[model samples]
Target chain A: MLKDMKELFKEQWEHHNLIFRMAKFEVKGMYQIHYLGSIWQFINPIIQVGIYFVVFGIGLRGGRPIDGDIPFLLWLLMGLIPWFFISPTMVQGSNSIYQKVNLVSKMNFPVSLLPTIRIVGNSFQFLALLVVLFIITLLYGIFPSVQLLQLPYYLLSMYMFLFAFTIWSSTIATLIRDYQNLLQSMMRMILYLSPILWDPMGDRVPDWLGNILKLNPFYYIIEGIRSSFLGGDWFFEDPIYLLYFWTLTFIMLYFGSRMHFRFRKDFVDYL
Target chain B: MAKVEFKNVSKVYDMYAKQSDKLLDLLSIRSKKSTKQFWALRDISFEVNDGETIGIVGLNGSGKSTISNILAQVIQPSSGEVTINGVTSLIAISAGLNNNLNGYENIDLKCMMHGLTVEEIEAVKPSIIDFADIGEHINQPVKNYSSGMRSRLGFAIAVHTDPDILIIDEALSVGDSTFANKCLLKMEEFKQQGKTIFFISHSAKQMKTFCDRVLWVHYGRLKNFGAKKRVLGNYVEFTEWFDQLSEEEKKKYKQNMLRKQYTVQEKTKRKQADKKNKWTAFGHLAMFIPLLVLGALIVLGY
Candidate 1:
């Protein structure tokens, strides 16, 4: 299992150029038919944030601030930005292998890079949204401080978690397409379950229940991103969650790679 | 040096009644199911030296494409082994071109996937375009191109990559005679450069003109692999004879061959399975134990 993971890592390292080039093309290809081309990448997410802001911040929360002085829109945007990246990436990355297998089957290309390509492709939009979030934070008078340096750490954490989940999910989805549908519904459930729309750290939710929900690795990411921007505890302060997240990610990576290498040559047969 | 060798290589494709059964079989959760195995290639062995252009001639359903796919490393053999010494590129009809991408983008995409640097791709880009000869259609999406144009671009890209082993699987059948002749000249140049090529085509006369040897496959088995004249002569005569048989007789002949392909390996496979049963039980435990522990951890709030 370790050997398989190492082999996949080596292949990814060797073909990193191909992965990046294909990712760039993927982002370009996404909106090639639209009149605005790539500009929709920004517009679509902003529209989603607007909808959630109205529904959750105004309609539900009475346009009130989250926690103390953090306006609901700013707080929601922080969590939703990463959620927007994570959600579509979950669907697209899971489908990447099944979609590209036929196109690349005749070549000697590394199949493991397909999921990575999706993850990286989706990151372009995620990074753009992060820039918007930063400028919004300044507009709201939240000055850049030492807490902002942790943004990179949280960003890396998000990528690692996405990589692990996508690799594993893509393998299962390719083998059993029903899993893809199941994953779609599960992402919807996760959106509600995570502290994205509502505050699990608020007064209404029970402490034990909130702790249970925090067990989700995505909670670590959504919360980590919010905390980095909103000035909360560092990731290291939550040692148990940090340990749990890394453990889960590595386990997924190990198994994902094992299954990936075992069935790569047979992927064409399946399709 | 022998650039390609196959030692008793065979490929078995299992026909699963339900897709879920495939997942179960992959995970070894189910010991056996009512699976039907189709042996595409059975115990076939051959070797090719550098610079040798071997023609693969077989009737439809004789597993000709299966052999080419295995040779190109697109699929793995079910048993035995194959050794390929250098980079391989396969050019089937419209193989590996993204339909949504334009012709020029397909060139860069394929070349990049083959590990060429950007500068290298740029250097070869013009020649590939010139050779494809699709003109202004190069800017149009590949989906809009005709089959002939698609194959033209496919052949152009495959040759430009300059693989050490090239397998052409009926890619020439879809192109115009002029383009086919152009490909043949380029293949002749490759032969002079000591590259091994596997040519699979129905045109016996072309095979005779170009190939150093011919491999005649009959229903997944190697009927003969020898000098060009001898094997092609035998194959041409066999096809002529088979073509003259009554329709019923032809049906009977095919049924008999396919039955043999299915049943020949059953006894050996069973014996091997019996031997494997013991280790498989232990293997199940090894996998199950870790999964059980992992489940416990997840349930315990990680």
Candidate 2:
């Protein structure tokens, strides 16, 4: 099993260019279905941001800033953008194996590329939204800070974390048909717990509870982005969260990989 | 001497009552309810050397497709192993073409997947285009293409990629006569280039025209695998003898060849045990409600 996992990694490495191009095609394929096409990528996120800002920012919080002086919209977006990237990647990546079956079943390609293609496809959209993030920050009168340089690192780590969950969910979802539905509902709940709408750093949350919530792997990525936007602590300032997050992420990654290797041969039978 | 080899490979698929049965069987360390195991191919072994043209011939439901699918690595064997010396390209009816993408883009996409670079694909694109001869429709989505056009495009991409082994299964028959002639010439060229080919067809004429050796598979077993004349001779004799058998005799012959995995008595025993197991499960849940009620009554001083 260990050797097989190593072979998988090697195959993935050797086919990195092919995976990247296929991801480009996948993203193209997604927009190809829509009449408005690639414009919807921006429009859909804008609409999501609009509804979220109105609901949580105006209706619930009375348009008041959740994090002191950081506008509710900016704070919400810092969380929402990452949430947007993570949620879709997880959902779509889980379905990637089934969705790409036609493209792959006839030809020879690295099957590992299927899940990662979702990630790569989503990353292009995520980068586009990052531009929206900067535009949103500028509107809030927040100047670009040097801490923003660490954005790529946070993006990398966050994708790694989500990619682990994505492949894990994809593999398990194939075995148990209900797992896909379960993940859909779970992602909805996770959105609330992820400190997106509510600020964990605020006085509203108890320090002990807030500290535990910070231990959530999503919170680490969200807070990292927040720190970049609001110009707060550098990511590594608190090394324990970084260490804790990596430890959890690595365990999940290994477990996810093991599940993929075991179930991969049996996928045709199940499908 | 062997470019492709199978060492006693057998693929047994578990025929389940439902999808959940598979899940249950996987979860349980020891299954209480047995699954019916159907051996798609049983203890089959064969070898084909470089530059050989082998035809797989069999009657319907004789595991010919299963063997080809295994060779193409679409499905794996339940036991034993398959060793292929070099890359094998499978060109079937579907041939893994993404329907959403245009024919031209798909060519690049599939070639890239096969580890060809842009330069390599560009070098081969004109010939694939020439062979397929679909003209401006090459830019159209593959879904829009006719089955013949799809096969043409698939064949064009597959043969042009320069694979060491080629497996073609009933795919080329969909095209027009002209395209079929073109494909035949291309296949002849491949043979001249000394590549191994596994061609499967129902028509004995095609087999006789192309194959250096013929494998006659009957009911998942290799009835014969030898040179063109011998296996074909045996297959002809078998068919003649089978044709002579009466209706009842033929049915019995089939049943004997493909035996039932479980007897009727064993099936009924399993059904009875399943009923008992379900009762115990319901009993556990049914007992829980009253036990909870009794505990509640005691706690409330009833």
Best lDDT goes to which candidate?
Answer: 1
Candidate 2 ranges beyond 4 A from true positions: A1-9, A101-108, A200-212, B236-256, B260-302
lDDT (10s digit) by residue, model 2, range B34-77: 55778778889999999999999998888888888888787788
Model 1: per-residue lDDT, tens digit, B69-128? 999888889998899999999899856687767888888888888878899999999999
Model 1 residue runs over 4 Å out of place are B31-35, B264-302
The candidate that achieves the highest TM-score relative to the unseen native structure: 1
Report DockQ per prediction, comma-separated. 0.41, 0.16
lDDT of 2: 0.81
What does candidate 1 score on TM?
Answer: 0.92
Q: TM-score of the second chain in each model?
A: 0.87, 0.81
Q: Write the per-residue lDDT of candidate 1 for residues A157-220, one digit (tens) a residue.
A: 8888888788888888888889999999999999999989999889998777777787677888
- Reference-based lDDT, residue A222, model 1: 84
